[model samples]
Target chain A: MNYPNGQKKIISKQATSWQSKKSFSNRGMSLEDDINTTNQFYLDIDRAVIHKKPTPVQIVNVHYPRRSAAVITEAYFKQASTTDYNGLYRGKYVDFEAKETKNKTIFPLANIHEHQINHMKSIVEHEGICFLLIRFAAHEETYYMQAEKLFPYWYDKLHGGRKSIPYEKIKLDGFHIPLQYQARVDYLSVIDKLYF
Target chain B: MNYPNGQKKIISKQATSWQSKKSFSNRGMSLEDDINTTNQFYLDIDRAVIHKKPTPVQIVNVHYPRRSAAVITEAYFKQASTTDYNGLYRGKYVDFEAKETKNKTIFPLANIHEHQINHMKSIVEHEGICFLLIRFAAHEETYYMQAEKLFPYWYDKLHGGRKSIPYEKIKLDGFHIPLQYQARVDYLSVIDKLYF
Candidate 1:
């Protein structure tokens, strides 16, 4: 993922500036869109079968029109009980949640839900590969933090400790997912290095 | 998972008959409900991490109130590109589409979609465990048909062959999933015999 020294600095500066201009949180239309494009590329090349689960909705009412599709007249979003993305990768169960933070210092622990942590715990216990993809928008970096690493932090938060993982801590412990041409969020490469 | 062994008619037969009368045209509300409950049982006991993906919906309009959660005003169901349920089981990626057929002699191919077949093809190619959970409500029998077994029928249909799988053929080729108190479908035992 090496770029010309000048080009790398220029790109970093532009992304750093995006922290303020992009008021929209990554809950998640930006990083998610890139990951989806990356997943499609992986699928086209016969690499993996990862997909973001559809947004869960509670349908309250439906209007069935004659000679037309049933329209949902009233519905509400349901909080997910599991991670946002999961699938098979290289004959292994891959599960992960992805989030982007504009914060330059730390990633707030509140970005993740308690149930999601429990879900990750179960995946890890079952010997499946589980992790988090944390994107620091200020630095334009995405880190792959293993479920094992995340548990301690979540436990610490529950124990009324620091409510965030410092950027430096993540930079030291997490693998930097390289930005690529087709696989924009090239995570499998990191999985290969760590697991394979 | 063995029951009293005398016809094994413990599960509410009256409800099954009622469900067939109001069958959702093979969209599988009856079987889907049972499978969802079964999956929860699996998760509770730490046997598997299977989940039914949320029904895909196209949100057309949403109203954001100042002091409450956003409500979807208009939406429509979208066709799923993949199967309904998938997750990790026995360290293997498990994927399947569950459907119930009231037909006594044949399971219709129309119950599945073209994209789902392609998605199954991909899963099989990647060495993931993929299959179909076909339940015959009339006979109260459920069969676990492997993805490999399903491909030939799909191709045959494309080549102007039979548009449905015969009940007898399924009985011969597919494994019978045992009815259980917890794992209602109990397909993993069949998986143990085949893939494990």
Candidate 2:
């Protein structure tokens, strides 16, 4: 009973049962799906309480015809001011943004917004665990780079440095997230080693 | 200048500056507005980073006309599975649901959803600070009640007990959130006292 729409199915109870599978070894799902599955797994075992924020939408007009639910007739997509996923881990505040890039050589800085960068900086200043989850879809590899580490490259772009992070550089700096049967992207194990 | 529409003014950046008025003593605003203003004040002083989750919407049809932004032609409101607000404070994970009631005698349990109650329970089990911010709109008083304290009443309702919490009980058990000039609701002060 897999739905074609990822967002719809993820919100449904069926998705929770779907994740009960022993493995997703070669399913080739999107990075969002994998992370959502991992989050659901974390929630089920009382390990963490993280969630992906809903897509921001700007509503202009809504029509109330009859007694049914009011329908949004005119609306536009709005940019999110913060990251996609946030939650609690080990009684510590964790905040992160996840992005998937098709490029094989580099991950572009344009994938993240300026406001979001500022938001992450503020979180780190407040002693929160902030990071960026970068997924190279071409290579099927993901890395978790701390916001502190990424700040250097982000500031370099303003000073006429490269606009993207090279794959080799990420391999050197960022921690690789291993995929597993229960915890799809076991990034927390890395956090436990680094931050804790 | 107060706008006629609530949504328009809320999503605007100018609203943050509007809170420069030393106090919200006379200006009657909803609990949500007060909390947002308080959060902005916290952020300005590097105190905390808390935000209310946006209202969820389910998009049915979207149209891309010309080079402008993508317009959602049809959409419907969706019920949120978790609480309204969540974030980090003092390197600790904090999660809470805020609700306002006009009732003067008791706070009805029906104001909260079963899933939200369960969600908060799970958050507490994970060793996260979880609570409810209940505002008595008539009296203009707010109280912060720990989720652990509320669990007994929540379970009692299932056993044919009282469906509402008496005002006297809340006054005895819950901590009063003093209204302040800079921080409107000043719930964080209560959090500081209890959790810290």
Q: Candidate 1, after superposition: displacement of residue A46 in Å? A: 0.5
What pairs collide in candidate 1? Answer: none
For candidate 1, the per-residue lDDT at B107 reads 96
Worst 10 residues of 1 chain A by lDDT: A1-10
What is the C-alpha DockQ of each candidate? 0.28, 0.35
lDDT of 2 by residue, A34-139 (tens): 8899999988887888898877777667776675666677766677878988988887889999887889999999999888998899889888999999888878
lDDT of 1 at A75: 66
Off by over 4 Å in 2: A1-27, B1-26
Lowest summed lDDT across 10 adjacent residues in model 1 chain B is found at B1-10
- What does DockQ come to for candidate 2? 0.35
Could you tell me the lDDT of residue B165 within candidate 1?
A: 99
> Taking chain A by itself, what TM-score does each prediction score?
0.85, 0.85
* Model 1, docking class: acceptable
Off by over 4 Å in 1: A1-29, B1-29
Give a tens-digit lDDT track for model 1, residues A1-196: 1211112222233323322234444333367777888899989999999998988876666776776666676666777889989988888999999988889999999999898999999899888999999988878788999989989988999998999999999999899986667888999898898889
lDDT of 2: 0.80
